[model samples]
Target: MSVHFEERSGVVPCKTPWGSWYQTMEEVSIEVNVPPGTSAKEVKCELGSRRVELVVRGQQVFKGKLFGTTVEDEATWTLEDKCLIRIVLMKANREAGNCWGSLLDGQYSADPWVQDQMQRKLTLERFQRENPGFDFSGAEISGNFAGGGPDFSNLQR
Candidate 1:
């Protein structure tokens, strides 16, 4: 239940056992960490019934699960001194929202979608870093292979 961070995106997962989740009269706030120099446009957040996914640089990084309370779609995020992304989620059931367990203490892992997208994004980012000045965008798959099996179609987009 320790807090963990993915170095690639510098994402500090929310709702981990390490995070503090508390509810006020109308909202629940969770603190997260993002990379420095992360512009507002570079970060994309998606809220589901129980999970919150964050997409940065076209990479799915942090996916946090809200165990008890249902969160509203509209969320507010503010930047801290050293690139901390604080997200406050609106509680669907505000009156009894305080009846939850400890917020911090469980493993925080991204969802399957985040895993898939992050794999591709990290691979591309690594390739770009290793091969500077290479036109990765123009690179083509010759379509001629031994097995003719899975290709980089998923990695393309």
Candidate 2:
């Protein structure tokens, strides 16, 4: 797990129905890259064995699952605010190998979710480049930008 991120500023850790997560209220510089033809409304997320069910204000929106080898896990979807994705992984003392693995030597091709995540990340990078001074603190589905956001309901096929 080699996750490299710049020092985030004004970030506060918060908890949701799924688990504890963190976000920054300030415009922190996050060096990232996205794929081509991807829009800003998407986010590429990678997780472990844990799978999450998305809910908004107590309403169910989407369900998620992780795919990969026993050592690595990966998934992707559009970014949304106020939407929580619950990850369900553990069962009967058995661990689901979804999020922990060596990505360097792991399988990265032929995984639909991984591709989606990559596209979403690229979209985010483009969004950051376009909006040089805006904070991505509240970029979830609930929040709306001046131009437009990712169409979570509609994904590229």
Candidate 3:
């Protein structure tokens, strides 16, 4: 199960048997693709604080523990185009900016590229926290970032 990482959206595509997933600092979105023309009534999705279960067409597609805890009450699932199931789960610890290594425990861990991006995000967040006067929201730190990035040391906030 190879996963394709999209740099712009930060989405890890199709690492699981069911589908793809992406995450923000606050929540995770899972996209499960079913056969075209499948009805919503035929899909059953169950979300818990540390687990998730999906059943399609009366057969269990996936059932496993999650990599991180989520707010069960805030989780939601919706059927799109009659074939795609979108699940959104709010993290229990959103303020921490914790990155999930994978959607399911012991399975589909993020690739090196994704992990690098996650670490970069975390570092940018820490820089923002340390220097509240500067906005790091759109900053991109790369190989030559130090040489090409803006000089903030002398900037007046």
Candidate 4:
């Protein structure tokens, strides 16, 4: 099957032959869709600081080095409804406003649209950081802000 990715929540999910994944500032969530009635024992996941491997039904679905470091000890996975595998990985470097361009290193990178959204998110985070007293949580960014966006460095409350 061809790899397919969809944009959601201002980020593009990286779809793979095994499943799909998206990331937050502190975590990465992966969803592996397996056949119906598949048992939990059929799924085996190995997560490390910089690598991950998933095996299903005795078949290695995915094995690759992760794009960033993760706290493997804090990672968690669950088999839901006997067919869906949900995995959450905690990033070791939970730096504020940081974003990952992809799940796996040197592969399955985010598209341009997703990259733009990530840039916007980082900009908003900078705004929030600079203006601690103001809440930029509900701020909305629109239009093509690439290259030469507004400079709020001089703005004072």
Q: Which lDDT values do the candidates have, in the order given?
A: 0.48, 0.31, 0.73, 0.73
lDDT of 4 by residue, 1-157 (tens): 4221112225436677667887655678899999999998788899898999989999887789998899989999899999899999998876544567788887777788876766565555555556676665557788654532457557775
lDDT of 2 by residue, 1-157 (tens): 4221213222232222333332111111112223344343443344334343433334443344423222223233343232433222222221111222112133212244443333333334335545567643235323332123353435554
- Candidate 4 TM-score, C-alpha based: 0.72
Instruction: State TM-scores per candidate.
Output: 0.43, 0.23, 0.72, 0.72
Q: Per-residue lDDT tens digits of candidate 3, residues 1-157? A: 4222223324435367777777755678889889999998898899999999999999998789999999999999999999899999998976424777788887767787775666566556546655776767667777522222234557676
For candidate 3, the lDDT comes to 0.73
Q: Write down the TM-score for model 3.
A: 0.72
Clashing pairs in 4: none
Provide the global lDDT of candidate 2 against the true structure: 0.31
Arrange candidates by TM-score, descending.
4, 3, 1, 2
Q: By summed lDDT, which 10 consecutive residues of candidate 4 come out lowest?
A: 2-11
Better of 1 and 4 by lDDT: 4
